[model samples]
Target chain A: MSDPDRVLLCYCTCPNPASAQHLAETLVRESLAACVNRIAGIQSTYRWKGEVTSDSEELLLIKTTAGQFEALKERLLAVHPYELPELIAVPVERGHAAYLEWVRAAGGD
Target chain B: MSDPDRVLLCYCTCPNPASAQHLAETLVRESLAACVNRIAGIQSTYRWKGEVTSDSEELLLIKTTAGQFEALKERLLAVHPYELPELIAVPVERGHAAYLEWVRAAGGD
Candidate 1:
């Protein structure tokens, strides 16, 4: 079994399907992520500057290992349109072993 | 600042939108989760009965506290349709402070 902390699920939001698909494909193709799931039509409310605003956004659930995170983040920033995109990484505590292994293996060093 | 591990982003999949909405609303109403983001139209490939299968599933991105996780998991297990639902908790390492605080405050003790 892999160390739970080794795997990460990174959360990021994109303005549309085009950007979302591009980012997801980039991560997987570059071996920076095992898989990326795009969740569409989400309403996100956040305080930007001084006002609270809500926007329709697409969420990308990027699955990768800790070792691949820095590179992943760098790649995301290079292509993502937002000046400061939301990139939060959450560490997995426990998961289905087989699936976890698949995730770990998918990101080749 | 909240301990990074204090906030959990639980991942769970539902067969359809109705079940996903039900689960998300239940957790928020019961104060077990601060919020739940339902991601519709996801393709999940997994192994079942020694065979690989892919299914269209809705993914729930549940935000809650470590303090509320036990109760949250219990409620999820009781209400989730699948005999064995995927309830994986991932600990947030970092996030926008205000957003993280909002997540913490939404769940009343």
Candidate 2:
């Protein structure tokens, strides 16, 4: 059984579907994530250089473990288009036991 | 200034867009959430009753605070359709200060 506390759900936004899919596949294929769920049709509103900006973006919910976060972040940044991408990890307080295990195994840690 | 540690990003999934939108709006309008971002076209794969299942779902990225989590959870459960809804709160380790404040004010605490 995987430690639930170590499980993380990292959130990031992509400019388009192709890039999102590519990133998701790369993460999963490289075992950096157990699974990557790409959510389409999201509008992000935020501040950029003192101005409020909105953009249509695809969100990537990357499932991995805390142990792998550092490496995952490095790899994501290397390929990501944004200068400052949203790489926030929210700890998974609780989840299905089997599903959590799958995440651990997929992350290869 | 709102303490960063008190902020939370709650994650949940709905069967469709309307319910997700309704829940999101209700949370924001009722001051239970600062803002709710809905992402459409997500596929969730998990196990249920010893069987693996996959479903098309919409994900809700709910921004709130730790101080209001309990009430938020109660309200979410009351209106949520699932018998066992996925209400997971992930701590926001870091974020843009201004954006974080927006979340806090929107959640009303």
Candidate 3:
């Protein structure tokens, strides 16, 4: 059995290239993340004003340990600009041995 | 420049399809996320034991507004089995207006 509290996935997005780099560095310096993967060109869809719409966006995948979640969130809250910033985590059920251990070591101070 | 305080990206992962579906449902039902995009066949590379290793994994791309983030995380933590879940958030600076509005409405109870 895996401890839900042990690992975390920090998902984020930015309008441009600049903010993405800024946030990634902030998380790392604060010891809230081990690595940040910045991916460009993501298309998204949602309903607004009773209408469905879509747009292009950038995505960031942050890898960190569970223990650092709270602090990571705080750092994010302090700098993000949306009325409600997005922050969601998924439980990692199973994975390859080397990757799991890599995550453990990388997401540490 | 945009305010570094609004919008967020929530990222998480699971070892298989079943867990991914479960978490996506949990987030949507709880209104922490408006939608979850489940993508299969992600190849990951990382270093462990001072050596680089790689593997294939599944990916979950979740979309939710800022307000729903914390609650969404709580729900994910409640059911995840991993010692650490992947949770990362990025700021949304510029995007299609329709999509932004949609995110705001869908992420609410």
Q: Which candidate achieves the best lDDT against the true structure?
A: 1
Q: In model 1 chain A, where is the ten-residue run with the lowest total lDDT?
A: A94-103
Q: How should the candidates be ordered by DockQ, best one leading?
A: 2, 1, 3
Candidate 3 lDDT over residue span A1-109, tens digit each: 3352455666666656677788888887776787888876554444435444444556778877666666777787778765556555544556776776777776564
Index of the highest-TM-score prediction: 1
* Per-residue lDDT of model 1, residues B9-50, tens digit only: 788889999999999999999888888998789755443443
Model 1 docking category = incorrect
RMSD of 1: 6.7
Residue B16 lDDT in candidate 3: 76
What lDDT score is found at residue A17 in candidate 1?
80
Candidate 2 colliding pairs: B34-B106, B34-B107
Task: Supply DockQ values for each candidate.
Answer: 0.21, 0.22, 0.06
Deviation from native of the Cα of residue A10 in model 3, angstroms: 2.5
- The residue-by-residue lDDT of candidate 3 on B1-109, one tens digit each, is 4432345666677777677767776666656777665655678787868999986666667777666777778888888767777888665533334446656767654
How accurate locally, in lDDT, is each candidate? 0.80, 0.78, 0.66
Worst 10 residues of 2 chain A by lDDT: A45-54
What TM-score does each of the candidates earn? Answer: 0.60, 0.59, 0.50
